[model samples]
Target: EPEVTQTPSHQVTQMGQEVILRCVPISNHLYFYWYRQILGQKVEFLVSFYNNEISEKSEIFDDQFSVERPDGSNFTLKIRSTKLEDSAMYFCASSEGQGSHQPQHFGDGTRLSIL
Candidate 1:
Protein backbone atom coordinates (compact mmCIF):
# COMPACT_ATOMS: atom_id res chain seq x y z
CA GLU A 1 0.00 0.00 0.00
CA PRO A 2 1.10 3.58 -0.58
CA GLU A 3 1.99 5.45 2.59
CA VAL A 4 3.06 8.98 3.43
CA THR A 5 6.74 9.52 4.19
CA GLN A 6 8.34 12.34 6.19
CA THR A 7 11.97 13.30 6.38
CA PRO A 8 14.13 14.00 9.45
CA SER A 9 12.08 12.23 12.07
CA HIS A 10 13.52 14.87 14.39
CA GLN A 11 14.66 18.42 13.71
CA VAL A 12 16.55 20.73 16.04
CA THR A 13 16.65 24.44 15.32
CA GLN A 14 17.25 27.70 17.10
CA MET A 15 14.59 30.29 17.67
CA GLY A 16 14.18 32.77 14.79
CA GLN A 17 15.65 30.30 12.33
CA GLU A 18 13.83 28.64 9.42
CA VAL A 19 12.79 25.08 8.86
CA ILE A 20 11.26 23.29 5.93
CA LEU A 21 9.66 19.94 6.66
CA ARG A 22 9.13 17.58 3.76
CA CYS A 23 6.45 15.02 3.10
CA VAL A 24 5.50 12.64 0.33
CA PRO A 25 1.75 12.09 0.44
CA ILE A 26 0.09 8.91 -0.59
CA SER A 27 -0.39 8.53 -4.30
CA ASN A 28 -3.99 8.95 -5.53
CA HIS A 29 -5.22 11.06 -2.61
CA LEU A 30 -6.84 14.42 -3.29
CA TYR A 31 -6.76 16.40 -0.06
CA PHE A 32 -3.64 17.02 2.01
CA TYR A 33 -3.29 18.51 5.47
CA TRP A 34 -0.75 19.44 8.13
CA TYR A 35 -1.34 18.99 11.85
CA ARG A 36 0.83 19.46 14.90
CA GLN A 37 0.96 18.20 18.47
CA ILE A 38 2.83 19.78 21.32
CA LEU A 39 4.54 17.37 23.70
CA GLY A 40 1.37 16.85 25.71
CA GLN A 41 -1.28 18.71 23.78
CA LYS A 42 -4.06 17.70 21.43
CA VAL A 43 -3.51 17.54 17.72
CA GLU A 44 -4.09 20.87 16.03
CA PHE A 45 -4.86 21.40 12.39
CA LEU A 46 -2.59 23.89 10.68
CA VAL A 47 -3.73 23.87 7.08
CA SER A 48 -5.31 21.87 4.30
CA PHE A 49 -4.51 22.13 0.59
CA TYR A 50 -6.18 20.86 -2.53
CA ASN A 51 -5.94 21.40 -6.26
CA ASN A 52 -2.91 23.69 -5.87
CA GLU A 53 -4.69 26.09 -3.52
CA ILE A 54 -5.33 26.35 0.18
CA SER A 55 -8.74 24.99 1.11
CA GLU A 56 -8.77 25.73 4.83
CA LYS A 57 -6.38 27.04 7.44
CA SER A 58 -6.36 27.47 11.19
CA GLU A 59 -5.33 30.49 13.21
CA ILE A 60 -2.07 28.77 13.94
CA PHE A 61 -1.18 29.14 10.28
CA ASP A 62 0.26 32.60 10.48
CA ASP A 63 2.31 34.56 7.94
CA GLN A 64 5.44 32.72 8.98
CA PHE A 65 4.15 29.50 7.57
CA SER A 66 3.65 28.35 3.98
CA VAL A 67 2.95 25.12 2.15
CA GLU A 68 3.56 23.95 -1.38
CA ARG A 69 3.08 21.03 -3.68
CA PRO A 70 6.44 21.22 -5.42
CA ASP A 71 5.49 18.33 -7.65
CA GLY A 72 2.88 15.65 -8.20
CA SER A 73 3.89 13.67 -5.11
CA ASN A 74 5.79 15.96 -2.80
CA PHE A 75 4.15 18.29 -0.30
CA THR A 76 6.25 20.65 1.83
CA LEU A 77 5.74 22.94 4.82
CA LYS A 78 8.02 25.91 5.35
CA ILE A 79 8.25 27.81 8.59
CA ARG A 80 9.80 31.06 7.43
CA SER A 81 10.74 32.01 10.96
CA THR A 82 10.79 29.44 13.71
CA LYS A 83 10.14 30.00 17.38
CA LEU A 84 10.63 27.93 20.49
CA GLU A 85 6.91 27.32 20.63
CA ASP A 86 7.17 25.78 17.16
CA SER A 87 8.67 22.69 18.72
CA ALA A 88 6.26 19.83 18.19
CA MET A 89 5.46 16.76 16.22
CA TYR A 90 4.37 17.76 12.75
CA PHE A 91 2.13 15.28 10.98
CA CYS A 92 1.35 15.03 7.29
CA ALA A 93 -2.06 13.60 6.52
CA SER A 94 -4.16 12.93 3.45
CA SER A 95 -7.68 11.81 2.65
CA GLU A 96 -9.38 10.19 -0.28
CA GLY A 97 -12.21 12.71 -0.55
CA GLN A 98 -13.12 16.24 0.54
CA GLY A 99 -15.61 15.35 3.24
CA SER A 100 -14.93 15.26 6.95
CA HIS A 101 -16.39 11.80 7.00
CA GLN A 102 -13.43 10.52 5.03
CA PRO A 103 -10.67 9.07 7.20
CA GLN A 104 -7.23 10.67 7.04
CA HIS A 105 -4.02 8.70 7.01
CA PHE A 106 -1.07 10.23 8.87
CA GLY A 107 2.64 9.75 8.80
CA ASP A 108 4.56 8.91 11.95
CA GLY A 109 5.61 12.55 12.23
CA THR A 110 8.53 14.93 12.11
CA ARG A 111 9.56 16.06 15.56
CA LEU A 112 10.64 19.70 15.20
CA SER A 113 12.81 21.10 17.92
CA ILE A 114 13.49 24.79 18.41
CA LEU A 115 15.72 26.17 21.08
Candidate 2:
Protein backbone atom coordinates (compact mmCIF):
# COMPACT_ATOMS: atom_id res chain seq x y z
CA GLU A 1 0.00 0.00 0.00
CA PRO A 2 1.10 3.59 -0.56
CA GLU A 3 2.04 5.71 2.43
CA VAL A 4 3.12 9.22 3.37
CA THR A 5 6.90 9.61 3.68
CA GLN A 6 8.96 12.29 5.41
CA THR A 7 12.65 12.97 4.98
CA PRO A 8 15.36 13.42 7.66
CA SER A 9 13.52 11.59 10.42
CA HIS A 10 15.48 13.77 12.82
CA GLN A 11 16.47 17.39 12.36
CA VAL A 12 18.45 19.74 14.59
CA THR A 13 18.53 23.50 14.21
CA GLN A 14 19.23 26.57 16.28
CA MET A 15 16.46 28.91 17.34
CA GLY A 16 15.74 31.65 14.80
CA GLN A 17 17.10 29.56 11.96
CA GLU A 18 15.15 28.30 8.98
CA VAL A 19 14.16 24.75 8.21
CA ILE A 20 12.16 23.04 5.53
CA LEU A 21 10.57 19.69 6.27
CA ARG A 22 9.67 17.61 3.26
CA CYS A 23 6.94 15.05 2.69
CA VAL A 24 5.70 12.81 -0.08
CA PRO A 25 2.00 12.24 0.40
CA ILE A 26 0.24 9.13 -0.86
CA SER A 27 -0.51 9.28 -4.53
CA ASN A 28 -4.16 9.53 -5.62
CA HIS A 29 -5.02 11.22 -2.35
CA LEU A 30 -6.59 14.65 -2.64
CA TYR A 31 -6.49 16.14 0.84
CA PHE A 32 -3.16 16.85 2.51
CA TYR A 33 -2.43 18.12 5.98
CA TRP A 34 0.32 18.84 8.46
CA TYR A 35 0.15 18.21 12.17
CA ARG A 36 2.53 18.36 15.13
CA GLN A 37 2.91 16.56 18.42
CA ILE A 38 4.87 18.07 21.21
CA LEU A 39 6.64 15.50 23.39
CA GLY A 40 3.66 14.91 25.66
CA GLN A 41 0.89 16.81 23.95
CA LYS A 42 -1.97 15.94 21.70
CA VAL A 43 -1.61 15.82 17.93
CA GLU A 44 -2.37 19.37 16.83
CA PHE A 45 -3.45 20.31 13.36
CA LEU A 46 -1.40 22.96 11.67
CA VAL A 47 -2.92 23.33 8.25
CA SER A 48 -4.77 21.49 5.52
CA PHE A 49 -4.34 22.16 1.80
CA TYR A 50 -6.42 21.12 -1.18
CA ASN A 51 -6.92 22.32 -4.75
CA ASN A 52 -3.58 24.16 -4.37
CA GLU A 53 -4.66 26.49 -1.57
CA ILE A 54 -5.24 26.24 2.15
CA SER A 55 -8.52 24.70 3.11
CA GLU A 56 -8.19 24.98 6.87
CA LYS A 57 -5.55 26.26 9.27
CA SER A 58 -5.18 26.46 13.00
CA GLU A 59 -4.01 29.45 15.02
CA ILE A 60 -0.70 27.70 15.44
CA PHE A 61 -0.01 28.31 11.78
CA ASP A 62 1.43 31.77 12.13
CA ASP A 63 3.66 34.01 10.08
CA GLN A 64 6.64 31.83 10.84
CA PHE A 65 5.28 28.93 8.88
CA SER A 66 4.38 28.16 5.29
CA VAL A 67 3.52 25.14 3.13
CA GLU A 68 3.72 24.23 -0.51
CA ARG A 69 3.04 21.52 -3.01
CA PRO A 70 6.13 22.02 -5.14
CA ASP A 71 5.18 19.15 -7.40
CA GLY A 72 2.59 16.48 -7.98
CA SER A 73 3.73 14.28 -5.11
CA ASN A 74 5.86 16.41 -2.82
CA PHE A 75 4.51 18.62 -0.06
CA THR A 76 6.71 20.83 2.06
CA LEU A 77 6.52 22.89 5.24
CA LYS A 78 8.91 25.72 5.97
CA ILE A 79 9.62 27.52 9.21
CA ARG A 80 11.20 30.83 8.34
CA SER A 81 12.22 31.43 11.94
CA THR A 82 12.29 28.53 14.30
CA LYS A 83 11.81 28.74 18.04
CA LEU A 84 12.52 26.40 20.92
CA GLU A 85 8.81 25.75 21.24
CA ASP A 86 8.84 24.57 17.64
CA SER A 87 10.50 21.33 18.66
CA ALA A 88 8.12 18.51 17.93
CA MET A 89 7.27 15.62 15.66
CA TYR A 90 5.98 17.00 12.37
CA PHE A 91 3.59 14.63 10.61
CA CYS A 92 2.33 14.73 7.07
CA ALA A 93 -1.03 13.20 6.30
CA SER A 94 -3.35 12.56 3.39
CA SER A 95 -6.82 11.25 2.69
CA GLU A 96 -9.16 10.51 -0.17
CA GLY A 97 -12.18 12.77 -0.42
CA GLN A 98 -14.60 9.98 -1.22
CA GLY A 99 -16.27 10.80 2.09
CA SER A 100 -16.10 13.61 4.63
CA HIS A 101 -15.35 11.09 7.34
CA GLN A 102 -12.46 9.51 5.50
CA PRO A 103 -9.58 8.96 7.87
CA GLN A 104 -6.18 10.44 7.24
CA HIS A 105 -3.00 8.36 7.14
CA PHE A 106 0.16 9.82 8.64
CA GLY A 107 3.86 9.52 8.02
CA ASP A 108 6.27 8.24 10.66
CA GLY A 109 7.19 11.91 11.21
CA THR A 110 10.20 14.19 11.27
CA ARG A 111 11.39 14.96 14.76
CA LEU A 112 12.46 18.59 14.83
CA SER A 113 14.84 19.71 17.54
CA ILE A 114 15.61 23.32 18.28
CA LEU A 115 18.64 24.53 20.14
Residue range with the least summed lDDT across 10 consecutive positions in model 2: 94-103
> Mind giving the per-residue lDDT tens digits that candidate 1 earns over 2-25?
898999899999999989999998
TM-score of each: 0.96, 0.97
**What stretches of model 1 exceed 4 Å from their correct place?**
none
- In candidate 2, stretches whose alpha carbon ends up further than 4 angstroms from where it belongs are none
35 Cα displacement, candidate 2 (Å): 0.4
TM-score of 2: 0.97
The prediction achieving the highest TM-score against the true structure is 2
Cα lDDT of model 2 by residue, 29-48, tens digit: 99999999999999999999
Question: 37 in model 2: Cα distance from truth in Å?
Answer: 0.2
Q: CA lDDT of 66 in candidate 2? A: 96
